[model samples]
Target: MIGERWINLAVPLALLAVPLYALMADEPFTITLATRATILALAAVGLNIALGIGGLVSLGHAVFFGLGGYAMGILAFHAQNYSPLEIGPLTFAGTKSMPVIWLVAVIVSAMAALLIGALSLRTSGVYFIMITLAFGQMFYYFAISWSAYGGEDGLSIYVRNGFPGLNTLVPIQFFAVCFVVLCLALALNAMLRASPFGLALNAARQVPQRVETVGLNPMRLKLMAFVISGAITGLAGALFADLNRFVSPSMFSWQLSGELIILIVIGGVGRLMGPVVGACLFVALEHWLGGLTDFWHVWLGVVLLGIVLFARGGVVGLLTGKAGPHV
Candidate 1:
């Protein structure tokens, strides 16, 4: 069997190569599909950092994801209309720049995570999950009723946001931007996993008492991890909205959060390449299975059951014959 390290390298390489091939062959749809997978994987990666590492099973990550999407939508919307966004005593203008949008997305998502994690981290086991879910649902309903930015109707980006030195309107160029961001995020994940902070957080997850005994605040570590996770997921949400050129309340739905967890489970929890592999399989299955029948989710459900019962290590584990951090 191939080693996990090699498989990990190969998976990302294949992801890039296929998109590059699509661009060369003028297969814009294929490129778009790859881009979708990349962005979804990025979001899942964020969830993995908290769930896989810190044992934080948050069903409300959609809050941050939606926040990020809305950040982009609202900014782009205002910019397109040449209007200012006013809140209370503050007045702000919008821009179509991708960097600006991403910064806002990250900051907003991180701040929300801080607030949510502070409250949610006080609970353990299922309580934490419920709190997160409640927050997510709250945001979903709020987005639907807000009505300022199209409310339940959602917001659309008439034009793709601008990226420095690139024509984002070009499918291939936009895909490249997303791909590079995913790579950078993956690199950060790898580094974090190996860092002292990551190890401490993992240790806290397994034995909070021991971590506390050693003078580290387990809750603080977990909160920090949650915040970072939320920020990354938020960044992915921004990219996803850009890819579709739209943002809606659905982005905050509980279903989206569930799918992120499913992706982590399918790819291999705690594994570095888990989200990448899971996202690819998800997109491929949806494409193939949807064409065959309307109940593709039923098949998806069956696969998830099998993984939970038989292949706890996920696709990477099955292929490598071992479960390691390399996943």
Candidate 2:
């Protein structure tokens, strides 16, 4: 409990300290790195809901991430081109508003999750994993074939999307936006985990039969969790695309899905700060080790292997011992 309390306090302080130092040093790149960590952490937080609480191992979560990215790219592309988007008989003007884009991303991703979960939830074990992967691949190929946005070339935003009064082009300002969202998501995760629904969902994951005997529908619970998870991931995807000012089919790749899972595992499954720690480590490795060697992922693999074999509770567990639920 001591260790957990320290960690719960330390992670946010560390996150705050980075930006302060970067701002004082006039190093915008550091702020950008921190923003990336926050965004990736946000994505992992979404996945944590499904995997940690719901015990749903989805290898296709990237589909939602990519959907969010494309949502931003598509809207911004049309806005920049000064053209309206048309679908069927309806005509819509493109928007560069971040809030609008985020809403679209969440709604689209949630709808996709509902449809996918409705079918994929029918199976269990490896079958569910494969089905999710297949769906992800389908979206990936569709993105590649969809030439209107960029096809295999990818879409590039001419400018950062608008945010009411903030100059998102400023690295620190953008970082603050992302950081605030991460905190809110973490808060929501805490609320959800402590709610009755969360308890039932966790129980369903561990013992579906027991949950069923309690007159709860495990499938419905899982589906709701999956949809919420997708929506959050989709929102992260929108922020990510905005951060990079680019969107590509690669966001839908299975490797990305694997990386999101890795983030949670390396940080600590079911811990609120797990994704935050994992994202920080991942970004640091990608920056430092990546500069030294092209095979940086090989080093990441080594670290992951060590964590899996020795530190199953991840960095948090390593620091806190087997403590209570990480909040």
* Tens-place lDDT digits, model 2, residues 181-268: 9998888888889999999998988899999998999999999999999999999999999999999999999999999989888999
User: How far in Å is the alpha carbon of 170 misplaced in model 2?
Assistant: 0.3
Write model 1 residue lDDT over 210-295, tens digit each, in one string: 99999999999999999999999999999999999999999999999999999889888888888999999999889899999999
Over 4 Å off, model 1 = 324-327
Model 2 TM-score, 2 decimals: 0.97
Estimated TM-score per prediction? 0.97, 0.97
Question: What is the Å distance of residue 96 in model 2 from its true position?
Answer: 0.8
In candidate 2, stretches whose alpha carbon ends up further than 4 angstroms from where it belongs are 323-327
* CA error at residue 12 for candidate 1, angstroms: 1.0
- Candidate 1 TM-score versus the reference: 0.97
